[model samples]
Target: MHKNVYTADNAAMLLIDHQVGTIGWTKSHDVEEIKKNAILLAKIATAVGMPLVLTSSMEDNAQGPLLLELDETAPEAFAARIKRAGIVNAMDDENFNSAVKATGRKKVVVAGITTEVCVVFPVLQLLDEGYEVQVVTDASASFTKIGDDAALRRIEQAGAVITSTSQIVSELAVDWTMPKGQALGKLLNLGA
Candidate 1:
């Protein structure tokens, strides 16, 4: 626990701007698949009692609202998970950054719609502060494949560990022998 390693209990999951508007630019992956990944990530995080923060862009003006499935995946999050104006760029919004910090966990496991701006900005800022940052690459996408690749490359070079929703949930399980073991195995398709 010197400074860099992270544990499940010490991690917080932040989902940003996953509104309908953001989903429109998800040209790097199948839209339906992204939704499933997002839901599964949130569900696992909630089930493990991890701290979760859900944010959206411009509900009143953009995206309209977070998808119902995303909201239902983490019911304990309940309320104003929608915080951005769907600004397309929210890198400098302290409110956005502050909301993330409020969760009080230094290790951030984050994913967002659109890989370049939404996901990269927060990852860089969080890294600057010495917080252990893990970016879920498969859980995020962009308007194009190029943007997705570049964003991921930049984030990786900036010291962010590019990861995935699958890895996080699997590691947290520790074992299938525990109560949650069988369920996680089945969800992850490790069942026989």
Candidate 2:
């Protein structure tokens, strides 16, 4: 079978603030479910060999520390790549965007906190630039369901694809015969 239009090799995973402080504001998705999906998103990249870029607003001297599980699922080397952008939408922030662009991959699998700014702005910008962006909706959220929906609508209008983390992982996996297929299945608790 042929590779998907934009294969994982051409893709990058950008997981935004899955921080402990921001979890409360994620009104679109259940807190427990969001954490599950976040870890699963991390596992997907590990399984599929996709490069992941994690970013947070401000960890040190900020509101609170990041989720411990976030660092556990994504180690120092992985988390070290995390951008310490003070801006909500790292993609809109010059330094953050430059750092992401430096990775040199066009396709992006993105998730973030508060869908309005953190998730929405970046997805639309990337889409406008002709980048194939998959916004992981379930893996992100906002202060309210209405806000999250609004963000989704804006990104869709801009021609970006809104999807769940699992959906993004499934699409990138493409088939059941991938090299790490079984492992991916296990991580997602598919019981394969």
Candidate 3:
């Protein structure tokens, strides 16, 4: 597989700060929709046997814990939830960065709450480190539509792929005959 392509062999999923407190404030997308997309992404990643990393910002305080659906859907064996002290950017936290590096995959499918901050910060850094990054736009949210739009623009300007959850799932599956493909299609209600 080409390094530039986000095949299952080369891509991993990174979720950040999808907590109740932050999600409740999201204005760019419907809160329920964000939760659904996040859960769907997690389920797809799990079904495809992809490496997954999760992180939360200030979960002990205002952020609350990761959404229960994600927590339950993400595979425990293939996923690691990094506990950061106070780093807003998961890439800055040693544990989170190490978890991502340990995945041995260069392309990351990333999503998070507050697209302008938690999601974009680490995405820019990951791009700087020469990793191919794709941001799952629907799986992430911002305080306002303007904030989400601007953040996506910044990420694209930095050379990251700005894509949607369904697009990523399709790219990973490639063919409906494959078991992962069938599973993903069902999860996304695509009826493949």
Q: Is candidate 2 or candidate 3 better by lDDT?
A: 3
- TM-score each candidate: 0.88, 0.88, 0.95
Q: Please report, in order, the local distance difference test score of every candidate based on alpha carbons.
A: 0.76, 0.74, 0.87
Highest lDDT: which candidate?
Answer: 3
Model 2 ranges off by over 4 Å: 1-6, 61-63, 83-85
Among residues 3 or more apart in sequence or in different chains, the pairs in candidate 1 whose N, CA or C atoms overlap within 3 Å are: 57-86, 58-84, 58-85, 58-86
List runs of model 3 lying over 4 Å from the truth: 1-3, 75-79
Count residue pairs with overlapping backbones in model 1: 4
RMSD of 3: 1.6
Give the candidate number with the greatest TM-score: 3
- The residue pairs found clashing in candidate 3 are none
Q: What are the clashing pairs of model 2?
A: none
Tens digits of lDDT, candidate 1, 1-192: 435544557888888777777787689988888887877778877777778788777777656677778767777573757476545545456666677678788888888887787888878878887778888887888989998999999989999998877787776676777756566666678881
* Candidate 1 worst ten-residue window by lDDT: 82-91
